[model samples]
Target: MIGAGSTVIFHFDIKLSDGSAAESTRVHNKPAKLQMGDGSLSPAFEAELSGMQAGDKKTFTLEPQDAYGMPNPDNIYYVDRSKFSLDAPAQVGMIIGFAMPDGSELPGLVREVVGDSVTIDFNHPLAGQTLTFNVEIVQVIN
Candidate 1:
């Protein structure tokens, strides 16, 4: 059975509320591996796979909060148009990389470009959407 400390290998297909495919491990023939109780997955997701054996296949749906959670209003920001260069104009629906203080880059989606002001959203693109997970357990090492 799958439980804490168990290393599980599984293939998954993620679908959006509209029944469109979002992601799938089976596409590349690469299953995902994760140790139970790890922070890699949300508590709700872990609970859904608490008890299972190899070859078990299940489909479950999760609300927005249980998945990526709702989008935070504070994640939206407005920057001066001058901050963007002519080479990469700030257009709506564009994903731009913003530098962080830790020397890493974060992706923010351009929402709007008003007069001398550009709006960007840093929330996950899938936030606030319901998701369906089709999972097949390939192996479970407890």
Candidate 2:
């Protein structure tokens, strides 16, 4: 059974509330593996997968809070347009990578560009939306 401390290999399809596909692992013929109770998954997500065995298929819906959580207004920031490269001008709906203090890149979506101010939203693209997950468990190591 899949429970705490179990390692699970599964393929999943995620869809938005409008029934639009968001992401799927099977598209690439690759399954995902994760350890139960790992920080990679939220507690609510873990609860949904508890007590299942290999070969079990399940579909579940998660509200915003249980999934990516609601977007925070504070995550929006304004940056100077000059910060963007000429090759990739700041355009609305463009996802840009900003260098972090830790030397890693953080992705931010461009929301608006007016004069020299470019508005960027740092929230996850699916943050405020409910999502449905279709999962097929291929293997489980307890």
Please tell me which predicted candidate would have the highest lDDT against the true structure: 1
- The sequence of per-residue lDDT tens digits that candidate 1 reaches over residues 64-128 is 99988899999999999999999988999999999999999999999999999999999999899
**Could you give me the TM-score of model 1 versus the true structure?**
0.87
| Worst ten in a row by lDDT for model 2 | 37-46
Give the runs in model 2 whose Cα sits over 4 Å from its true position.
none
For residue 55, model 1's alpha carbon misses the true position, in angstroms, by 2.3
Return the lDDT, model 2, position 94: 95
User: Best by TM-score, which number?
Assistant: 2
Least lDDT summed over 10 consecutive residues: which range in candidate 1?
37-46
Instruction: List, residue by residue over 46-71, the lDDT tens digit for candidate 2.
Output: 88889988899999999999998899
